[model samples]
Target: MTLPSYFLDNPYNVEGTEVVGNKLSPENELIEYFVQFRNDDLLDTLNTFEFNLEINENLILQKTLMENKDSFRNILRDAITMGTILLNFDRDDMVNINLQGKRLRNNIKINLEVPSNITLKELTASDYEGDVVTFEAKVSYWSKKRTITHMADYKCPDCGDIITRPFKSKIKDRCVEDKVFYEFFKPNISEDTRRITLREISDDFSEGKLPVSISADVYGKTVWEIELSDKVIVTGVFRSIPLRMENGKISQEFIPTIQVISVQNMKTDKMELPDMELMKKFQDLEAEGKLVEAVIDGFAYNIYKKRNEKKAILCSLIGSIWIGQVGKGNPPMIHILFVGDPDTFKSTIMKYVINVSDNCVLADSTTVSNAGIKAIAIKSDDGRWSIRAGLLPEYHGGVVFLDEFGDLKSDIYADLKAPMIDGWVSKHVAGEDFNGRAETGILASMNPTDGVYDDSKSILENLSVLKKPLITRFDLITKFSIDFNNAYDTQIGEHFDKCDFEGKPESFLKDEEIKLFINYVKTIT
Candidate 1:
């Protein structure tokens, strides 16, 4: 029999048994009583006390019930607790379930693994943060290809001569025309032939199966050795003859010769020379001072941290200009003027840089007056033209240390104008245009006009050595001063005592330190 008309005709009823009752229905009193009774039964079955209706639209509830009538109530309750379904039972026609923001948590985790073979290079804190920091590091690993010495032993079958030699081969000919004819009476033909010929082969031939040894040493360590059969054939053109005479009579003669032949199949193998082991030995030797290592240790502590303020400034400025010119491939000639107090290290650093560099000259400005740092015309006994390089020209690829730079005569100062900028100094001495380019870095030092530098006045104003064009050529200018407040007499006394105890000569401080500093600078470049 069909159920009651109310139950069957209810639009919210999805199936025969499962029915969703709407709160906004006109028969709310009856629906509420039925819902309350059903909730009580569900609480008893599940052993839970609280139960609340997550009210949803009537049509959506009806549709969900229709799709899964058997599990409709359980599904509805789970959806409400998980926040996956939005509900509104007040309006029947607008009811709809949106399944967009649904998520579930399970037993899952993510991990990333890096391979062992991949190595990081130049890794530092600055790399991660993109900043610059100062630090020192040693060269960890270095690889360089070096020439390997090889020797071979072979006998010439045709000459019946035993020849042991070091051999090297090169491609001497390529594909060529086979008996080609130039005249119309003959036909021309070509053949492909790639051949190699021995260019050099060493000489060492001794009879019998003697103990032949071959060894290769890399960085003073033997890495490879091989002993081969004595019957190997040698191929090459003979350039020399080895002969023996008994009692002025010819007994035997060994003639060396070469013949073109093809090597059927060639095989090659490589042996890694012992490097790590030899490096360890070098390290041990370095520790014992038998080998020198590039490490700055006690040197820094023993050497005083003396700074030549003027020289440092000059180097920095000139270094910048030099680097700029190197970039443009048009480096300029440098001229500097240093007017400062006496006893300063003006000439010290100048001489230091000159000795350490590739080519340089140190001279007083007064000595280079008439010639102007370039050759002048001079008649020879044979009356032929001859040109000689002046002091500046001789200093190519290096620096010229000028002492007493501003002490030169005024006329000689004008001669420096062109060379300082254009790198050419010209003079009409001896009826010739004695012109030469001064492709050198200039470091000139001089004393101040009043014998001491004055900090109150500008450096350019105090030093009269710098004039308009000459002053502009300088990249930097600095003044040196001695501090009066921190004058410690005890320090000087201690230095004197140390010098006496060490039995150091009078010129020890000046000459020794300068020599050491020059040697150190030489290694850097």
Candidate 2:
């Protein structure tokens, strides 16, 4: 019952040992082997039709099967249908072929890996219509994993008639005889299906734009394996289905979903590195001259003075480029605190830093909580508790701007101590540990207790409202004072009024050069 030598000798043969130039077998080699084995058994397997073929994930885990997954799937489909026809059995009587694709390891080798390189904001239906696309993003949310009935056989409750249907068919479950109909009960045998949702890793969106929600559906063997909060690179088909409406009106809106084929967790190393060209350009700027000054001027072009403070902010932006392992063995990440009087542009500078940096997070100190600062464990609708990363971990390896710093409660300040000093934050919930490795620089600002810098009191005395443990964590602490009584305020106000009367203010850097400066600062290590 073995395959003939002449059949295996052809260059286009599926199970051939040698492949000729430009000729690829349309059939999977391992699947062809399975077909031969089935034929040699001489057992009437198709006549039994008792769902005996168990071609589940374990068979696909074989090296030969994985290497030829696509061709193997087609071969498996053809073999099942052709076998049923030859045995004079109904194709519908055969068991479902389960090819669990996700059971393959996250780093499984695939021939084609498309790097879409397009942001979630830019994705459109027409751009990649009917094609498979690949992109990398953080997992924003995970829906409850549930087994869905794909196909089933049900028996009539009254007449004892049996009927087969796909899962959730709109057709009524009824048996009819002589124009009389009776309802059917639940299925005795059924198949399984699975689904999940994948979303973009974005928090900020353009004004008036809705968030993107992408769902992925898996069947049989591809079910299970993905976890919440994992950073993944996914290859999937981009398609859309009509949104379900309450009134049943045919609305033009459609929900976007990616039919995922393969996925892998993204490598965490070099997550902070910029593109090579951007790195070279940043290096060239450093090699030239005044790289630090150029970045400072670009931070807030409208403001004047505060070079020393700007330099400290610069360190917070770039942080330290450390090698080897972290923890106590590495230099601590830089943190800066601005203690200033009202109307001195503390909030203004913080906003500018957030805008200029690529991976920055801006949080108002008055509104944040201890759990919100670190990580929070949330329970899903299905009662599964998962840890959702908070603001600090979301912007790791970048800058965090905390404004209105004086309003933070002391207890909330206590929670931030470890992350600021040790470069990691942890949350423990239900015996499960979730850790956020945050190598982020902190840029926080506070107002004087009296709302104005008290000239009569010493510097430390004016800042005594803040806890000493938190204060000591800052690498640089400075006070920004403004001459409120001086006539310069009046002159500046008058100048601003005149400028508004016209159309524009006096500008130094061109818009193009300002953008270049922002990009340069963002590329810094």
State the C-alpha lDDT per candidate: 0.36, 0.55
Task: Give model 2's clash tally.
Answer: 1
Best by TM-score: 2
User: Which pairs in model 1 have colliding backbones?
Assistant: 236-257, 236-258, 237-257, 237-258, 238-256, 238-257, 338-446, 339-448, 340-447, 340-448
What lDDT is reached at residue 500 by model 2? 60
Looking at model 2, the pairs that clash are 100-221
Question: Could you tell me every candidate's TM-score relative to the true structure?
Answer: 0.35, 0.56
Model 1 vs. true fold: TM: 0.35
Pick the lDDT winner: 2
lDDT of 2 by residue, 1-525 (tens): 122221132432333323445633433333344455555321243433211333333343244334544333233433333333323332233232111111121112222233555665566887865555667766644433456553355566666776656445444645665333434345433323344555676533212232454666543343444444455776666777666554867557766766665566665433344457655655776787755556565556555556787767766766675545676645446888888888888767666664545566666753355326666665543345545565566667777777777787775677678888778878774345767777778888888888888889976777888877778888888888887665878775775566567533333333344444544544564
Off by over 4 Å in 2: 1-136, 141-259, 263-291, 321-325, 329-332, 409-411, 458-461, 485-487, 490-525
Q: In model 2, what is the error at residue 361, expressed in angstroms?
A: 1.2
In angstroms, the error of model 2 at 312 is 1.2
